[model samples]
Target: MSQTIHINRVGLVALALSLCANAQSPQERSPIGAVLGTSTPVEELSTKASPAVVHIEVSSYRTSADDGDEIKNQTLTKRQGSGSGVIVDPDGYIITAFHVVKGARRIRVELDRRVRANSPAGELLNGKRRSSFEARIIGVSKEADVAVLKIEAQGLPTIAFSESNNLKQGQLVAALGSPEGLRNSLSLGVVSSVEQQIEPDDSLVYVQTDVALAAGSSGGPLVDIQGGMVGINVFSLTQRGREEGLGFAVPSPMVRFVYGQIRHYGFVPRPYFGVDVQGITPTLASALGLPTDSGVIVAGVGPGSLAQNEGLQAGDVLVSLDGMPLQNVPQLTWLLLHKHIGDRTRLEIQRKSSKIVLDASLISEPSDPEGSIATIDIEENLVAKLGIVGSARKHGTAGPSPTASGPGVLVVARLRESDTRAELAAGDVICSVNSVPITSVAQLRATIESFKPGDAIALQLERKGKLMYMAFEMD
Candidate 1:
């Protein structure tokens, strides 16, 4: 999303509060009263910021076959979900949590009247003053839990981003979202912590707040008193599905980084060294006969990977990357996250009392083996008939390197409904058609061309971790 500062809502609010405080100045005030200084209140900030927030509703369609009956007809199931988003660009670019739209076949966004510059006064002829618009997915990064969406509108209200790194603990913050499908709801809290680890080993962190967030609040904006957005509301710690006042958000820096990468590359280009590593503590270092008390130990190097090609092997203790010392797995992971594909970096490794320095190039990590399927481009006629879009999975592409096994035509995206009764989904691997194995896009196209319209065809698909058979008539 592009940056813009049209209204300067936060600045205006701050200025107004400062003037009010000056006007109410006194010769002396109680210590307690001084400590509890008043600025822009939560209600005022919520009202000023609510224009940029939007309600998001999504519908996902999936095909379910009868119990133990593959040849019979299938049923299409619709699952509905709701969340919130903030307009970051007046040109209709929206930022929201990835989980809100994951696997969704259709997405709709509702904007309040205030978002429109020329909207009417505060008058509600109907229940609410809102307008619905169809939203399209621009890109998504599941690892960062951020997704960018686009709606067909212009000159919409937007929220300003705050420097989350400067956020202090106990600072007041407000969360705005559609909690429990209630639009424009507000919650108040303070920053409990700025560095909260989600993974046990990774260095990734989230901003922790004491704000109580509900199910529909995910992807909403966490704003400061001045109405600047500092974080994205994500999830809350709960006991028995009850709120615990322990909410977490993806800090603004990470949100900006992920959003920029997705917008430019269509996906997050996560660099990979193709090596599994573990942190080596002092005790483990002594047992392994290592020189340093802290470092990262390479457990296994992938076959034919850059690590293997560069002579990196199991049991090699990585001491540093480039010039930075890596004392643990998190440090190494953090360093790798900043690197891009084709980036060459020097690595200092210790092997059996011998210190060695080697250079290795990074490559994009391959898609998850269990979740992603190889994609191939089929004939235009077949694509139009099937209402789908796909691309042939290339070998040794710029993105994540593919594994040795599970080579087949991958389904990239599923389009709208067609007359065909076949059920195919994104990330599904089309292994074969009519029992004929398909290895490439050309093969899939040729196989589909062999069958005439109205012919019943059997498709062998690999979804998630299971193999299933689907039968549909060609139309």
Candidate 2:
């Protein structure tokens, strides 16, 4: 009896062991267990995406006057800036942020040998140990913050892009870049917001993330877990010069659009509406005797423009475009950006209590008559005399203006002396000089030419959406 009882106990133990083994088998495991069972996907993704990443080194020369007693003596300063880029084509085409390579006299790209060697059309290894290649700028769009570059080498590893429109708010993403000059660094984060407007008047949309982007990370690829590029890491918020966790990126769709346009035309063709418009509030609507507040009012129409030819006059309220309601300048800019030259778009305008529908063809944006100021010699220009380099405030550009409708020249770079007390910054829009209303760079130049060095001038400026007066002395 004891032997039989022991045999039954052994059989029961064997049965329990068999059941446990079967439950834990790979085939018998639940789907959730299978998904959570491995870390290979993320690991493999990082390894796969790393090769196509390139480190961008840019060198720019800026001429600035020394703050010494020798005011007339100027110094040439060589500024070295670094950013990151991604290979997007096998023929060594790269896409990076325009700000990365902007004003750069020379650009060098450093690639991994392993990535180049693995390419299908890659040349066999010789004794050459070089990895850096001199890159040439293909095109740049400041408004979109995208730039294209090309190198002489072929058979480079490239990254694939995911469908940008399908990106979810909470999807997992990895930002690959040289943050703070650290090469090939990866930071993981989820998409905090899919669509974020960086500025009130700007129509450019960005992918907002908490991915810890730093100085050198600009123009780097923001990738997904599947090793697909989704966006280009662009900017992060800084408070008191300290980096913040809030980061933004140009979405892949915009990147691709700009890239294609630049590759084909050597520049993104900006479609021109040739009409200046402003959003109308309820009070402004009542004051203007308009029907509703939810429309844009045409402030000025360009002379001899298609808008003027189509009878779009000032004081006409734009109600809709192509069946979509036009509530603000941004909405109009956004629609215009997606359109191409020669494309016809219907506009519904409210003119004197009557709704008017006008068909207008988009034309290549006419170069600003004041755009020549960009090519003006910095040392000889009046703007430089004020210790700043600035551009005219236009309707579609980024900066602080009441919807970019204010008359001013936006300061882009400040080259002030240490002893100077001017509180002007890069984004400060100079509204006037010496109590004279300044509208364009040409006007600012004319005003500055009327004054001599050491003349104290009152500058009406807008900083961070606040209007303040500053006293600056001409150098």
Which number leads on TM-score?
1
TM-score of each: 0.70, 0.64
How far residue 49's Cα lies from its native spot in candidate 2, in Å, is: 1.4
Candidate 2: stretches off by over 4 Å = 1-38, 61-78, 117-126, 278-299, 303-306, 314-317, 324-331, 351-353, 368-475
Least well predicted 10-residue stretch by lDDT in candidate 2: 1-10
Tell me the tens digit of each residue's lDDT in model 2 across 1-475: 0000011222233324433444655566453343234433445666788889899998853444222425432333457889999999988899998778765668899885455423333434474534677888887777777889988777678899886668787666778888888887777666778888764346577888767788899999998868899999989998998756678999898888888888888877888567777767787778878887665788898666668988999989888889998867666877887898888889888898799999978877644312222233334433655656667776455332354337688765555443345656656778888788887776787787787778898988877667788886766
Task: Tell me the whole-model lDDT of each prediction, alpha carbons only.
Answer: 0.71, 0.71
When superposed on Cα atoms, how far off is each prediction in RMSD? 8.6, 13.3
Which regions in candidate 1 have their CA more than 4 angstroms from the true location? Answer: 1-24, 27-39, 61-77, 117-130, 277-297, 315-318, 327-334, 350-355, 369-408, 411-475
Tell me the RMSD of model 2 versus the true structure: 13.3
Overall local distance difference test of candidate 1 = 0.71
Highest lDDT: which candidate?
A: 2
lDDT of 2: 0.71
